[model samples]
Target: MSKRIWKYAFSSALVLITLSGCIEEKNLRPFILPELVNTPNYLVESFPGDSVLLIAAEGGILTRYADDRQYAFTVSNYPVLDQIDPTDVEVLYSGANETFWLRSDSLIITFSRERISNYRDTTAFYRPTRFYFDYCLSDDGVLHRIDYYNEIWDPQSGSFLSDYFLAIHRFEPSGSGLWESVETELSVRSDLLSSPNAVFKGDELLILTNPSYHVSSFRSGEVVAEEIPRESTFDQVVDPVWNTDDVIYGLPSEPAFFSPFDAIIELPLVAENSQRLRLESACSPSADVIGPVKVLKWTDQEAVVYVQYFTNQLTTANEVVGYIYTYGLKDGSCDINSVQSDPILLPFSNAIRDVALLNTELYIGTESGLLVYDFATLTMVPYLKNLFDEETR
Candidate 1:
């Protein structure tokens, strides 16, 4: 009741609280946290069996290991001027024993996993035109870029001053880790090819001219265009997948329309008996499919397709989902109604950016984090966990 007695009791409670805090700090364990700069837009196997690399949309790069922890690039590791921004990378491509970043303002930066700090700038030699639309690294270590130029009509002049063109520029890796400009070929006029997608197979360049369903093949300084005969009346075919020149598979759709994944068609490129096969009837009837379809794995006898579908429409909120299906094929003769297997629907609803298969696991790069689907276990696991919270951890 006295002041001296109250003061003594308060001092004793303060000492007990300090001792408990010390004990709590000593018993705490280290928590694993994500070091990602931003959403992982692209995923690649940076090192064989050791780590996977995640690239953000704005040039942030993180290396994720099997234990779920990540390693991010420090300021001293990459040049400040050429440093990858964690908020703004456009394209991250890994091929031909190196990785490339198509940065802002037509800057092409390439680095290897072995020597990441020793990066080389490829755009210094090519310089800038109006802009670049797409790029790829060919089999022979040559970089191919689709360059575009806009033609502006001068009101004061009688004629158009600047002409428009879409061309492919080639760059080879010269000695001392430098890229040298080699050749440039005119693909087509700016308005000639609609939704043109270019890819390389060995020494030949294949450009898909959509709506027409024609593939323009360029080789040895010569160009040849051939049509993929259609089985049904369709407006356009997108996402062409083919390993060999003998056959190609694509989804037929009406251009500029957000529709369901109705059917996928196969076109043979043989000299004789070349025809298209529509496999609409083989798909599952109950699958509520939407969004664009992508063929992930393709072989002579089978193809693995990923379809984005809509779900949870009956509820207050709507969600988009994904389904994976396998389609079988016959060598000599094939039937359109007997190829599809049952679909495997994914559990999560995040928008997928990219997907890659390694051994029995499927690595899916989503807008939020990385996910892995194991075929052997038939289970999906979130590879990267969310940022650490002190209270939860």
Candidate 2:
């Protein structure tokens, strides 16, 4: 080839490559990477037919279903708070007054309505190494927060403090400032395990310690622990639901509920007792099975229970598949009508942490984002990611 032709071809190639690079950069600039963090705790407050979904993880993301728009805000956005870590903020309650209560290691922050900018540090608690908190609203319009300290190991002191104490804090509106606080401590060493699930049933709090359950009276401070009956060999009791007359416990074979007088009443899932729901392997098997009950919601005639089943195959390295089962209860009998057998694969190592139901849709919460499944269309959509895309566009 001639020297002039070769030189012209070389210059044209360089220009084309540069233009392609510029186009690629411009296309990537609009995409915002999600902040990977722990799976968030989800709170759904329903009214009439709509609901307000709150995702508290790497900051707070609020979605109002009525409008189908979401607001993603971070605690660090408040410069006065000194760039508080968003993962440290745990949502406590979403009130009817359009306010939310959140807690960190050291402070309890309250956000007014849907405005993240309008917030205040309402109160403070002991900055423990690890903690879990749950709250219940009373009939008299008082909010009660139960603070459970799981671990209090101080590295500098080399001491394990906060052994087994639970705190109950009551909050009520007072004039124009923060809510009034009344703190009470309950010695719960005998009733709680190292890791226990705390649930509020009316004025009483129920603590489920895997195979056993405990009930604590807020009025009398009386604690009662009940063991599983010897006849029933259920693997675990989890995802307790509070009903008007009973407190239901999620079991493997049958659904059991404790009466007001502490009597155990179990409802059969199937007509034949031989075909019971078994969560464990009968013998030494090739694969390991793990079933964890996540949530339970009840109506007047039926109840819906959500459980996640995980299978870890020993043949492959890190090969795990997850299945989500939704069982419907009618006439004291249970049957599975919905199953999501996705392989538990999530972006940024996230897992399906929790699930909730609103109207005809199922809301699934993960470590990174939220997804919604419509029963009528049998389709699932990424709710949180779509909101981010819309905002950026």
Candidate 3:
């Protein structure tokens, strides 16, 4: 009860606090988002009502779908390239409105025009790459692929480059704006690889290869020139949807690629040969390989992401659960728990070939029919049901 006793008690408390700091606690962080409009448990809102016209992909039309027995709406608005056999045609996605791209099976054209939704302007054009053109994002969408254009300043070689730029491939709304080459047939496979959810950060376009992290650049399609270790900390780069540019490529000072997994990859309007800057990442994945995450629409405020969780319920026979999270580049914070549950359960996640977000509305293009959900109501309605019976969704 004297001074000596008081001193000893204070010392003991300090030691106890220090020891407690050394013990790691289990992480129980719940789903968080930036003012999520709907609960994560199910569809919360932002869906078309039943009275609204339904869209289906029964015959590969994106905007318009065949009704019970016949095609409905003004015209079929699906992606025509998706219907064409890839072996017979070459498809290239430009970074613009919902991945506007170009397609042609004829070498006589030898060029790609912007094609997506109702955006058809044969006059304006961009290069293409190996990309899946849904209504979301693309990796390295705005990245330019420089070939000749000899007048431009030489980068590594320091010469006025003479080769023609094969194509300037852009990924998201404002993604990496890097450089690629369509000079060779293997260029797409050799450079960008695959993975709809892949991300591009700095000079690294982290992609999902067969069994490795295929790291390239949206800038110079070449590696960083360092001895890229055969091994990478990332297991796989996947779910490579691209964000959209607010006003297409003509807009100045936009991002090249904004990915949930990779963050910002390339800065807009940078010199093609600019030294690669060591950009930072906050949501670096830790899995040996993580991919096929859900990609939402592109917004300047923040990027949204979702990871997959499998279930065994009859409804989830081969189900996939999507965990929604938002990453804010402007504020450098992530709302990992924007949902009631981290992984929102879905019975047949893979049943749908792809997903696109129109506002808060979630559209799933599946084998059977296109499913639209009203998040506010937590209700989902199947479109083109009878059509699915006749053909695939």
Candidate 4:
């Protein structure tokens, strides 16, 4: 369908869906976590080929859900609190056999086969480098991290007190279940704004820089940056997802108001043609914001894009609430207004920090806990409750 026609169709469907009370109501339940205190962020990851999920919440809380059994690791049982507090978890990611969580101070926690190990790579976790902006894990389990740093110059001493750096570091696992810096994969000593987004297509690492409109690829100790064609300039690119193909789906810094709708951009890392896909909010008339795009799996014809939507936009104060939608994808593009499906509302009290999908259910991690939303029945449930009483392992 054409873009305009698709928008109008979605508008009509949205009106009907809204009027029919299709959007599920908020029925949030409490998570049974004992030591989850003063935490407002949570990240989630799903184990491949199994019905298992791992949730990492702020305040140094980690929980796993396998079928009907829920297991948690907190300060009481997990003695690693001396190394880092429960509130230190800033990012949570999963690899084939291991799950990694980054602390606020750059301390990393690696979980494998029910064992937890903590390590800090001083080479990459140097001073003045506060946090990791974006990252991706390769098939071989190496983590490529993009971080920003700045320094001040002192002219009287004829030396630089501080300087700015945009670096990409590779962290590989060691024999002791810890991680060490393999190398400083790519570091640029420039003042240009860097996008915290990176993806791996086979062996090449693709990265982006804002305003500069350049996508850099790193491989075999060589870094080559190609400027995105001017016709497809973006203010910002966040939450990039890469499939087997060369194209990546990323959310622009902000959603377009109305005209010339810009929701998701199809960046051709190596291809010549660039395409921008349209995703308008049917629930909100004022704004059409899309949070992040994650490709659960890709097939020969289509891929399932799990996206978070920020609806009910207002000028003075936005609602800060939204639902989950599955945009249709084919031929390396998305059909936001696909006739095959309608937008499903999975409301959470807080903004979505991270999401993981298992089968027909979505594991949504928020500040409170993990929400399990069933796509088949359009219902939601909260997990990680009563955590402190018992510690698993």
Candidate 5:
């Protein structure tokens, strides 16, 4: 045989061997079933009928999670500051709209549908000795900002200067004109906490401090500051939700540890009314389940509470367990029923920050990521991982 012919035959044999190996490798590869993945550590807060979900995450990242059709966008630019910290950042969304406000260290950045604008005033009116402010959006589309100040002490004079007062600014939008700023009378006080919890009920702004709740009317400039009624030591209110017409729901700040017994207080907005209701009596689950109340929501028919609990059975150390307690309120009565989740599907930590319900699915926010609990399957799934996995692939 000729040398050229022999060489050709050898090359053809090598090619066939390579093709056979490729075929075998393809057949041997196992199929991977798609599983849930962790999303950005976002505190999920959504609005009704709104396609975009705004989240306040770590590293000063403002995440905009749109509908499944669009990709997520993040905004972290703070032009005035050298480094933006997420711990100092507070995000608020315009209800049922794509607009959102990001307040971080004395700067307020507004993210509209088309543009982003930043606001900060170092002048006498809006100036802050400390870099912090708390704000809320009213139902009439007015932005209420509360600037906090601490009392300055003079060691030379041996007296404290009364500089503690809340400067309330109402940013009202005109007839498609620029937002008009109307300043109200400075509610004089000495014990104003930094970044107090504020919410909007209809047109009134409800501000909750340590021992008092300040109810202000933006239209008439009427400010009412009243002490919080002390029924129990556990009445220290935290995370107040303006769920209904006249009631504000909040979890007690006491008993910080995990307990099967948890209480949710329904506080009235009326100044003359000190009557409060404890919602814990309505929630009765098995003794093995125990957790703290993370979030509360009230609908026309039911009041839903999200609790992070664990079972006594053997499970993975990183497993997350929780329950969705839904109370059917009939004539101001609560009939509670809970849906327990499987242990394997829960987040690793019990740091669930927020919760919202859309249709029949329940969405939860935790330190790890966003989780979705399906009412039909009685299962919990990681949201962000499943959302962006296909994009990465």
Candidate 6:
């Protein structure tokens, strides 16, 4: 063959091998079944129907009014800050003295005793766009590098978790912060879900079956899971700064989870014959799953649950919710109705609402006021404002 013909033949052979390899890699994972956890109301979840009121704390005892009729703080006290659309705030980490950082959309704000700062486009990696927390909990004690345009989760070690990452559940930094980590995952009959929500106990991990909203603890050297009534999967659990407590949880998918038509025919995480709890709410018709359930805090007895609502059907062009709900152990649930309703009143995007609990306070990261919780209380300091201002300058 001529030189050109020889080259052509080699290219054709390479193409065949590449195409064949692509077909073989379609499924790199093998099939496995979801391990059934026999518990009551363990898997199925519920969310609140209406919006909740979240007050914007502007240092000391000063708080601003709601931007709109909504309850959460939509605008900040700082004149130079951009308004945050109300989303549930996530990861409230206290900073040096009166400073703290709010992670939203890959941007980390350093709210000092002053205002909001402008931010570059960035985000937390593991946290998807609609996912509430894209930021990890951090403080001055730890040094975090800017990785993946500020999107990647920087292991406290400042590098990737390689070789045996799957076997390693706890990512601890010796001198990072006064905080650590907790990981929890939802599995249905053996299939591993997206995020693993773990509750950090000083020397223990209170693992919820995701089977029964009930919880049980596991220490570093203990087995992977302990028993919790052979049932009881928590709807959501959040671990705050305190070294010894875990906020436990339970849930009801609210207006949507109770849908008379497509309601979960079989509760996702409970006994085969468990009865479903029909809840009350005022969500618009055709809302999909009530919302993704997560922990604002968890303890053996008392626990706080955070639920975000998406009321449109699967057919809606783009359905999103700016509402959050909190539920507890007793006979009452608090609805913090601090959210912005006017679509065009803030930044131009489908509303993305998120929340985080720091110390004894709650901060809502939205399209309006970046941090609405009161700082100076030594809990969560506002970083979004600082970040916003830094960039703006």
Q: Rate the local accuracy (lDDT) of all candidates.
A: 0.46, 0.44, 0.33, 0.51, 0.53, 0.31
- Candidate 4 lDDT over 98-146, as tens digits, reads 4655554656666655467776655534355564366667656566776
Better of 4 and 5 by TM-score: 5
lDDT of 2 by residue, 1-393 (tens): 699998999999999998888643334444333332123534332332235455554444443534544444553554433444554444434434544555554455555544653334445554551344545545343456555533334457654433445555566445654444333333334223333344564555554333333444445444443432333443333333444545343443222111111112232221111123332222111233234343344443444544443433222223322323333332334444343323333432125555566666666666555666656665555655544667777
Per-residue lDDT, model 1, residue 364, is 64
Each model's backbone clash number = 5, 1, 63, 12, 1, 84
lDDT tens per residue, model 5, 1-393? 699998999999999998888644334433222221144454555553454455554423333335433323333344442233545555566754456776676566666654566666333444443544556776654567665544444468545534445556676534543334444334434443344556776655666553345555545555554545544332434556666566666555522225422665566655423333445556655455555454445564556665656554544533445566766544445544344444455424455555666656677666666677777776667765544454556
Best of the two (1, 6) by TM-score: 1
Report the poorest 10 consecutive residues by lDDT, candidate 1.
Answer: 334-343
TM-score of predicted structure 5: 0.59
Against the true structure, candidate 2 reaches a TM-score of: 0.48
How would you encode candidate 6's per-residue C-alpha lDDT over 247-364 as one tens digit per residue?
A: 2333333222223221111122233132222222322322544443444553333334334554332313222333333432333334432233323322332222445454434454
TM per prediction: 0.53, 0.48, 0.38, 0.56, 0.59, 0.32
Q: Residues 1-393, candidate 3, lDDT per residue (tens digit)?
A: 599998999999999999889976696543211111111211111112111122323343222211212222111443342344322322233333223233333121111122233222132233333232211123433422222111222367655432222232332221332222332111222233322223444344432232223344334433332222333222222223223431111111111111123333322212211111111244443342133244453355565555433333334222223444566645666554311211233354444344445445455544444555545554455533322433532
lDDT of 3: 0.33
User: How should the candidates be ordered by lDDT, best one leading?
Assistant: 5, 4, 1, 2, 3, 6
| lDDT measured at residue 311 in model 1 versus the true structure, 0 to 100 | 43
Please rank every candidate by TM-score, starting with the best.
5, 4, 1, 2, 3, 6
User: Against the true structure, candidate 2 has what lDDT?
Assistant: 0.44
Candidate 6 Cα outliers beyond 4 Å, as residue runs: 1-168, 172-195, 209-225, 232-247, 250-329, 332-393
Model number with the top TM-score: 5
